[model samples]
Target: MVALYGALFLSAFLAATILPVSSEVVLAGLIVAGRGDPGLLLMVATVGNTLGSVVNWVLGRGIDSLRNRRWFPVTPDRYEQASRIFRRFGEWTLLFAWLPVVGDAFTIAAGAARVNLGVFVALVAIGKAARYAVIVAGGLWAMA
Candidate 1:
């Protein structure tokens, strides 16, 4: 049981990063397998995923200094485009941080834009929790 929860957490965490992990698949499988409490699984996944976004935020904070380096992952034009969109949409975009590739970019942009941490966490958590809740409900419904 503990191992299942841990794996879910790790999967959720990695899924939020640049890595190609898919936490949703792990979560759906666990729910279908009846391996853990659905609510607890949802909570674990949400927290893990939110913390993973935080990692991206932290990286964004330091990205400016390294942006000029040739080895930097994001090109200036791409970074600028993301920044422009973020600025246009404002911090409210953090609520969509659960989105796949785009979500990671949003978190990073929030950090670069110096969004308030409290706002970031609150919005991100709400979005992630809501997503997990839907997944949990769907999995339960399928079982029914």
Candidate 2:
């Protein structure tokens, strides 16, 4: 339903942020409950998750503004180190942006590293879409 997609979108968005939400749970619940078409659910989840990663990328771009804040989660040295790693490892690492824990960090680092925006969006979308595809396929397979 419309409300389900909205919840999935919000959950996916927050999951990609510093917050600890589980869009996956919402995704799986929808899948198992047979609420929406599988393809539609996959697309919605992918877009929502990708957009969340984009927020992290934008936040990465503003790291300097936040570095001095007492509430900043990352220390200055860690930021520098992550930047260095992203620089050395290359933007291909953006393919892992769908991962938990460090996935958001990768997006943030990509922003801090000033990765080409087109490349960032393309790679992030690919990774996130693939993840949703796998989840959808897995859930369907399990039910079958």
Candidate 3:
């Protein structure tokens, strides 16, 4: 049981990063199998995923130093434009951090924009928890 939960947590964590992990599948499978309490699974997944986004945020915070290097993904002008856009409309986007691909981008943008950490965590957790809650409900309904 512990191992199952641990796997779920790890999957959720990696899923939030640039890596192509899919925590939703793991979560849905666990719920369907009745391997653990649904609520606990939801909590573990949410926390793990949120922490993973935090890792992206941390990386973004330091990305500015590398923007001038040839290896940097975004041009300085583009990064500045993104930062400006994020400063204007980015915080609210954190609420959708549970999304894939773009969700990871949003988190990193939020970090680079220097959004308040507390605000970032609250919004990200809410979005992630709500997503998991829906999954949990769907799994329960399917079982019923």
C-alpha RMSD by candidate, in order: 2.1, 1.9, 3.1
lDDT of 2 by residue, 41-113 (tens): 8888888888888887888889878668785545666667666767788898899888765677788898888
Candidate 3: where are CA atoms >4 Å away? 66-85
- Steric clash pairs (candidate 3): none
**Model 2 bad stretches (over 4 Å):** 68-81
Residue-wise lDDT of candidate 3 within 21-90, one digit each (tens)?
8899999998888889999999999999999989878767878674466744445565565556567785
Error of 2 at 2 (Å): 0.9
lDDT of 1 at 56: 76
- How do the candidates rank by lDDT, highest first? 1, 3, 2
The model with the greatest lDDT is: 1
Query: Residue 28's C-alpha lDDT in candidate 2?
Result: 82
Q: Please provide, for model 1 over 66-118, each residue's C-alpha lDDT reduced to its tens digit, 9 standing for 90 to 100.
A: 56777544556766767787999999888888876568778888888888888
Instruction: Name the lDDT value of residue 107 in candidate 2.
Output: 88
Residues forming the 10-long window of minimal summed lDDT in candidate 2: 71-80
> What TM-score do all the candidates reach, one by one?
0.90, 0.89, 0.86
In candidate 2, how many clashes are counted?
0
The per-residue C-alpha lDDT of model 2 at residue 66 equals: 69
Each candidate's number of clashing pairs is 0, 0, 0
lDDT of 2 at 111: 87
